[model samples]
Target: MLLDTFGRQAVDLRVSLTDRCNLRCTYCMPEEGLQWLGRSELLTDEEIVRLVSIAVTDLGVTEVRFTGGEPLLRPGLVAIVAACAELAPRPELSLTSNGIGLARIAAALKAAGLDRVNVSLDTLDPEVFRTLTRRSRHQDVLDGLAAAEAAGLTPVKLNAVLMRGVNDHEAPDLLAWCLAHGYQLRFIEQMPLDAQHGWDRSQMVTAGEILERLGTRFALTPEPSAARGAAPAERWLVDGGPASVGVIASVTRPFCRACDRTRLTADGQVRNCLFATGETDLRTALREGGSDAEIAALWRAAMWGKKAGAGIDDPEFLQPERPMSAIGG
Candidate 1:
């Protein structure tokens, strides 16, 4: 197990396939975008599979989530997912994407052993979508979601970040659409992970405000805390039973104490936390002919030094140099 000093074991691993995205979401990166990672810098398909295999067979990682600037942009995604699925003690596989090209590959991914998906869809309005993403691909995302459902990706999840004035009022509408469409909706508090570093605390819509907006449309009953386990989202039953909604208040309601996740960048760097400033380079070790046991030990050491919290509430908090796009959502 990847055990930290704080007694949290990392059973969940987030792997970034590439630092390239098709859309330019305003909250994640600038319109022009940051310098893309060189092809030679990214881990090869074989390297990714080997590391993930080690994490599952050697280490105790039980869940593997493929993330990216947009994972669908990776040319070898289906093959990677298929390889990872063949590992002993196979991990539950999922992906986090912008859903730009998901419509075309949703079936392929499902057939390749992908268990589910979490696609970012901030608003239902085409105009709002175009304004936020700086692209007119709103219909593509909707089609992608429908494709995911048709492909049997159970409980297809939608991740939405609510900005203060922009699309904040659409909270209720977003929830209604999710409930009606059988998709799990999670509203996240915008964090200081943008490449522009223009995040303002006051300008973010808090979890309280989100629930308050949602209250006007649907009656929500809080799920028991005991049932939440290590999941980041705090869920509530919509109208008393069955369907539900969730809030990932990473800024307002930190769940650091119960965090069970570890991250790997596209370059094969181990990130202990989402806001971590330091990284453990496993790629170099892998390229240098290090044994699997040696690489696993290095990963274990990195997680052991994870900070107690993200420190977003600290007086001297600093945003990570790498934006969410590079860091993998």
Candidate 2:
């Protein structure tokens, strides 16, 4: 295993397929267009494949998750997943999407060997959903869920960012709906990753509070299926249903001690911590004709320098300068 300075293994890479997305969520990106990477500046399919091979064979990486502004928007996504599926050790490959175009492409994605998907959804109210996502189609996302289910993508994960007044009340209904749909619902604590203002604890609903709310209707319990202690969420059986609810307390309860993921931005920067001050720019070196060995060396150096934790709730912690879209949320 390729262990970092803090002895965190580089077993997972959240490779972003693209930095362009259709929606403009309240917490994700500013509505104003930001300068995107030019076509020539982005990593080629071959380069991406080579990197994945390096991560698997050279670093013993066991997971490669595809994330993005909306990963499904990437033209080369299916091909990339196919290449990842061909790895020797067969790292667990997954995708996180906004589900805007999923209904149209879910089947093709499944055929390309994507193991599972985490769909971002904030509210069940169509108008509120539109307000939250700016210009997204709630119906299309709903269809995307249906299509994913029909395509045999079992345990489709729903990622709901729990904002204080925005959609916190949607929690109970959202969990109940996912239970009926056989989907896993995970409530993420709203971190001020790229927020307009620095993250405020007042805007957050803590995991303890969430569980307290859940206990009213459902008999909540911890999960045996949690990955030792890596799972930030405490799982629960909801109201005699087969479905379960999870809470990822990233902002309120930080998961720094057991953090196991690294990120590769769309522009090819390597980020040890999402909230780190800056990234090691592998893209510039790659575009400048640096050798694969040299690029790998940089990757290794950055990994070893991983930050202690992404302090989302820390008062002194400055918000990342880069937009969430640019950094591949």
Candidate 3:
């Protein structure tokens, strides 16, 4: 493992295939999306695979996740997954997506060795979904969910962002929907990741409050923390049975101390944390024909300088220049 100065080992890597997304969600990007990186600015599939090889073989990374504005927007997504899966001592592969075009490619993705997926679906109400995402693609998302399950993506995780007056009232209904459909649901507290820099904690619904609302309808017991201590989400078994749910309390309860992941943006920058201000340029070196050793060294140096926490609660914490869409979610 690549150990940092704080004694934290980097064991997970999130690679953004592309910054382009099909949907324009209110919380993620602007109504008129920001200018996207040109095709030449993004990392080629081969370049991405090479980096993943170094992360797994040299740095001892055991898990890799693909994230994007919406990963499905990448035409070469399955091919990318295949390349990563072919790595010697292959790492576990997963993806996070908006699920807009997923229905069309779900089976192909599974055949390419994608182990699992997390689909971001905030509201189940069609009109509410339209209002939040600025698109009427809710049915497409639902179809994608069914397709994923049919394609054998077991325990298909659903990620829902909790906003105060937006979709927080449907917490129970969402949970009910997931439980009935054999989907594992996770509620994440809204963070300062919007392209508009309009995240207001005062208008955010916290993880604790979500749990309170959920508990009123169903019994929940905490899973042993030791089993998933390093994971971002705190999981629980709903009704003490087979069903489960998770709450990512990034705001009220920060898990920075145990964070073991780093991110690579679609534009080829390495970020130690999601909220990192400083970025190490890897694309320039790759395009300039820098050898594997040179690129790997640069990556190690960046990780070595990672801060202990994101410090979202700090008074001086400024919103990151890139939003979740540009930063790879």
Candidate 4:
């Protein structure tokens, strides 16, 4: 496996298929969505599969996740998943989506060889969902969740970004809904990834606060962080049964030390860290007909230079030029 300077193995890769999204979430981007990359700039499906092949066969990556402003927005999404699935010594394939158009494509995606998915559903209330996402696709998200379950996407995880006064109070409610529906819900701490640069550390909800609120109504036993080994979410068993919950404290409790994932932007820049200010331009080399070994070497060099942490707590920390939508959440 490719290991960074800090001894963290790069085993997971997030590939952004497109920078276009269907919804403009309050925490993700401005009401008016930002400009997207040109068609020619984005990596072609064949290029994407070639890179994944190198990662799986050469770099020892075991998990391949497809992300986007919303991956479903990409027309060849099913084909992409199918390509990744064809890898020898096949890697686990998953996706993280806003769940807006998921209802229509969940079964097809599963049939295309997707193993699982993590849907971004911040609220169960229609009005609140509308306010957070700035879209009336609230029911669409719910239907998508149902569709995911029907498609046999086991453990259908729900990712909710918790802001101080916005959806922080709904932790318990969200967990209840997840438990009832057999969905594993994770509350993510709001990070400085918004396009509007409106992330205030003080206004962000912490993992401790979320646990406290949920503990009031549900008995949750904290699971060992090492159980998942570099997986972003910290796990917990809720109500002492099949129910469970997770907290991704990206701000208050950073897990950069054990981060094993690297990212590839839709436009083909390789990011070693989510908050890394710089990127290694793989697109330039790819378009110029760079060999697989050449691209793999560039990838290795980028991973080798990865920082010890994202440094969100650093006094000198600066947000990336791209927002979460552009970066692929």
Ranking by TM-score: 1, 3, 4, 2
- All models, RMSD in angstroms: 0.6, 2.0, 1.0, 1.1
Span of ten consecutive residues with least summed lDDT in model 3: 161-170
1-329 in candidate 4: lDDT tens per residue?
Answer: 67788888899999999989999888888888999899988999988888889889989999999999889899899998998898898999999988888889999989989999999998878998888888889888889989999998776999998767777888899999998898999899888998999888888888999999999999988787668678788888887766678899888878888898989999899999889899999989988999888989999999999998888878999999899878876
Off by over 4 Å in 4: none
Question: How many clashing residue pairs, candidate 4?
Answer: 0
Q: lDDT at 82 for candidate 2?
A: 89
Clashing pairs in 2: none
Full-model lDDT for every candidate: 0.94, 0.79, 0.90, 0.88
User: What is the RMSD of candidate 3?
Assistant: 1.0
Residues 1-329, model 3: lDDT tens digits = 67789999989999998888888888888888889999999898888988889889888899999999788888789999999999989899999998888899999999999999999999999999988989999999999999999999766999998667778899999999999998999999999999889999888898889999999899999998996868999988898976789999988899988989888999899999999999999999998999888988998999999988899999999889999888886
TM-score of each: 0.99, 0.93, 0.98, 0.98
lDDT of model 3 at position 204: 84
* Per-residue lDDT of candidate 1, residues 195-227 (tens digit): 999999989999999999999989999999998
The TM-score between candidate 3 and the true structure equals 0.98
| Model 1 regions lying over 4 Å from their true place | none
